[model samples]
Target: MIMSTIFPEADVTEGLKSAMRLYASGVTVITAGQGAGRRGLTATAFTSVTMDPPTVLVCVNRNGQAHDAIVENGHFCVNVLCEEARDVAESFAGMTGKTGADQFEGFEWIETRVGAPAYAFAQAAVACKLTQTLETASHSIFIGEVCEAATNPDRTPLLHFNRGFHAIGALK
Candidate 1:
């Protein structure tokens, strides 16, 4: 087994990233804006915060193109990817070398009540209205109140771990 230790004076950024890669997480594409202004990005930093008001949070890099669109639109949709949507994930992640509206060219998207675009074939989609924003050094934590949601139960979620995409297998 391999382990890394962080010292007080050591830079922890790379270590932190390396450590996080071992943690498997569901993949998602967060989208915001409408029409010509639409933007989306592949992300895994999303979680449900509460059930009371159906709140959720997504962490987006402040420097990402979709970041400003999310803030200015005041809404975003978290589209949980299914295993079959790996191409969609790659496109939005800039792996296809497409940016902005181009990233959405080949996929069908539906607009939620809050005006954010949601992937039509996602495993699940949660539409949220931006309620709060907490800024960190390099990212903003977007806290949202879920306004609408949809799901495709037959599909299994896409997951990321060890720098690769994976699908669920039989239970241990």
Candidate 2:
């Protein structure tokens, strides 16, 4: 099957972005750093890399503040947002006017054994140690070896589609 039949030679950026919006993905916060240096950003470019080693991959914007810390510290957490965590997602995505440590102010967080902080009330979370990294065009692909993980099965996951937040309904 062809992924894209129309290859725009003009501006592929807009074409690619619009095509990707057709896929529904879960919202997550890619967090790094500690204490006063903590930083995070909302991302939907996350996925399981492997099951045997319990690995995962998250694509982080290279220009984000937490990008450098994640590379320097060699650790990060993927906090899967629940439907009710839309505010947290917005804050981390810089849509709430909160930046740096201020984004974490009202949220309850718990530090994992690996030193990355996970959301206390997220739909799910994964603490990972950076095992590999690759620089793409505009983002860093972090391959993490999952050290710890948690999930709240009762909560519905928050999703992103067409540049909007959505709640996944349970299937009967």
- The RMSD of every model to the true structure, in order and in angstroms, is 2.4, 3.0
lDDT (0-100) at residue 62 of candidate 1?
96
Worst 10 residues of 1 by lDDT: 2-11
Best by lDDT: 1
Badly placed stretches (over 4 Å) of model 2 are 1-7, 169-172
| lDDT digits (tens) for residues 15-129 of candidate 2 | 8888888778899998888998888999998999999999999998898888987998899999999999999999998999999878998999999878888999998999999
After aligning candidate 1 to the native by TM-score, how far in Å is the CA of 172 from where it should be?
13
Number of clashing residue pairs in every model?
Answer: 0, 0
- Tens digit of per-residue lDDT, candidate 1, span 43-65: 99999999998999999999988
Top model number, TM-score = 1
For all candidates in order, the CA lDDT equals: 0.93, 0.90
Tell me the lDDT of model 2 at 73: 80
